[model samples]
Target chain A: MNRIILGVDPGSRATGYGLIAATGESLLHLESGFIALPAQLSHSQRLARIYQRLESLISRYNPEALAVEAVFLAHNVQSALKLGQVRGVVLLAAGQADIPVFEYSPLTLKKAIVGYGQATKTQVLLMVENLLGLTLNNHNTADALALSLCHHFHSRWPQRSVSPAAI
Target chain B: MNRIILGVDPGSRATGYGLIAATGESLLHLESGFIALPAQLSHSQRLARIYQRLESLISRYNPEALAVEAVFLAHNVQSALKLGQVRGVVLLAAGQADIPVFEYSPLTLKKAIVGYGQATKTQVLLMVENLLGLTLNNHNTADALALSLCHHFHSRWPQRSVSPAAI
Candidate 1:
C-alpha cells in the first residue's frame, strides 16, 4: 500500500512542511519547504497567511494524513500561547480538508529517526538525510520530514509503543 | 452612519459571541449566544467547531468589525495555550471574511461599560444590561456584549485613551 503524508512544524513566524510517500518498505521524499511570514504583517495577517499556504499545500499534495509534533512543555507562557495559536490554524486547515492528524512528540521523533530518544537535532537531521537520500539544510524542514517518517513507521508497526518521554 | 460589530469571547470548551448595531448615539442589541462544545470532541475538533460557528455568524450578521478581548496575563501556561488556540480560530474566521478586528483588554472593556476600569464582573454585566436594555444571564455572553460596546465607544471617541492596565 502506498500512503502520502504531510508533516508540519508550525511556528508563529515561520512554518515548515514536508511531504513523503511511503510505499511498502520504501520512503520517497516528495517536497519540503518552509513559509517565512513577513515581519510587517500583523498577528492576524500572519495567521491568515499560514492558513492559506497550508490549504494550498494540502490541495496540491492531496495527502491522506497530517503528521505534526505534539505540544510538549514550552519555555514560557507567552511562547506557549504563540505556538498554540499557530497550531490552532494548522489543525483547522487539516480539519476543513477532512484529513486525519497524528501527533508525535519530540522524543518519539528522535527515537524513530535516530535510534535514541535523547539524540541531538544534528543526529536526527543526519539520519533523516541518510534514510531519505536527500540533503536538508533547514532544521524546521528536517524536523517536519522526521515527523512524516515517524508517522509512517508508527502506521506500519502499530504494536510498537513510542513513549512520549525519553526512554 | 450605522455599523454592525461582532464581539467574541473565545474559549476551548465554550465560545461566546454577540452582535450589536451602532447608529447615531444608540446601541441596539442584535443577537447574543454561546457555543457549548461537547466534552468528547478532540482539541482539533473543538477548534474546527469554533471556526465554523464564527464563519456562520459572520455570514449571517455581516458585521463590519470583530471586537475581541486582548490577551492578558493568563493563570498558567497550559491555560494560556488553550486560550490562544481558541483565539486563533476566532481570528482566522474574521481574517478569512475580511472583517477588521479590534482588541480591547478587560480593563478597557470594564471602563468603557461601567466607567471604572476596576469594576467587578457583576457591575460590568449590570451596566451592559442597562446600556443595551436587555437581560444577559451568561457571563461569557455578557462579556462579549461588553466588548461590542467598548468598540462602539472607542469608535465614537477615537481620542479616548484606554490603557491596558487597570486605573
Candidate 2:
C-alpha cells in the first residue's frame, strides 16, 4: 500500500489543492480543486474560511502528509505581505491536524514536474495532465498536486535523490 | 463640516476600529470599539461574518474616508503572517464599502498620537486615549483608531509640507 499525499498551491484569492496516492513507481489522483475567497471578503475571514475548508478536507481524505508551496515573493511587496497572512492560517490548519507538512520552492516544484526550473503555468498544466492521464484543467490546484507527486517519486527512489534528506 | 474618517486596527483574534468626525484642529469621537472573531471559526466563515458586520457599520456610519494600519512584520514570522492575512480581509472590507482607504506606518501613527516615533506599545495605548480622551484597553484596535485619527490630522495639515504648490 503506497502512501497518500496532499499538495496545496496556496494564494490569497484562491488556493489550488490536489491529492494523490502513491503506489510504488506509479501514482493515482484522488482529488483536486480550488479554494477561492473573493477580493471582497475581509482578510481575516478569507483566512478563516481556508482553514475551515482545509480542515474538512483533511478529515475527509486523511492523507499521510501534506506538501504546500513555500511562500513566494515576486515583485509585489503588498502581495507578499498578504500571502504571509494566508500562509499563517494554513500553517495553523496543518498544525491542528498534526499532519507533517513539506514546503517546496516554486523553482523546485516546477523543475520536478517539467525538468525545467522556468516552466510556465500552461506547460506545468500540460505536463501534469500527461503524467497523470487527466483530461481536466488542473490550474493552480493541479500544479500543486503535481509537486506533491514529484516529491513522492523522488523521495522513494532507491538512490534517495529526489529531494535532499534534509527536506 | 470637517471630514469624517474610519480607522481600523486589525488582529486575527480581535479587530479594533474607531470613527472620528473632525473639524479645524479638534476631533470628536463618534464611535469606537473592536470587532472580534473567535479563533475557533474557520477562516472563511470569519471572512463572511466580517463582511456582514462591516457592511452594517459602513451603511450606518457612511464615513468620508478610512485609515488603516499598514501590515507590520515583527519578530515572530508566523504571527506577522497571520496579521497580514487579517489586514487583507480588513482592507477588502473597506474597499467593498467603497471607501478610499489610507494606510499609515505604525511608527508614523505613534509619532502623531504620542509625540514620539519610538513609543512603546504601552505608551501608544495610553497616548491614544489621551489624544482621543478615552480610557480603554482594546490596545491594538485603539492603536488602529489612533492611526486613523493621525492620518486625518496629517491629511489636513498645510498641503504645502510636501511640495505645497502640488496640493
Top candidate, metric DockQ: 1
What is the DockQ score of candidate 1, to 2 decimals? Answer: 0.48
lDDT of 2 by residue, B59-143 (tens): 8889877787665454455456556656655555665566666767777788888889898888888877777798878786677
Chain A TM-scores for all candidates read 0.93, 0.87
- TM-scores of all models? 0.93, 0.58
Q: How well is each residue in A1-167 modelled by candidate 1, as lDDT tens digits?
A: 78999999998778889999999989999999898888776677778888999899899989988888878678888788788888889888888888878889888899889989999989988998999999989888888899989989987877886332110
Q: Kindly report which residue pairs in candidate 1 clash with one another.
A: none
Segments in model 1 whose C-alpha atoms lie over 4 Å from true places:
A162-167, B161-167
Q: What is the DockQ of each candidate?
A: 0.48, 0.13
Q: DockQ for the candidate 2 complex?
A: 0.13
State candidate 2's TM-score.
Answer: 0.58
The candidate scoring highest on TM-score is 1
lDDT of each: 0.85, 0.70
Residue-wise C-alpha lDDT for candidate 1, range B1-167, written one tens digit per residue: 88899999987768899999999998899999998988766667777888998899899999988888987677788778788778888888887888778889888888789999999999988988999999989888998988988988998876876432110
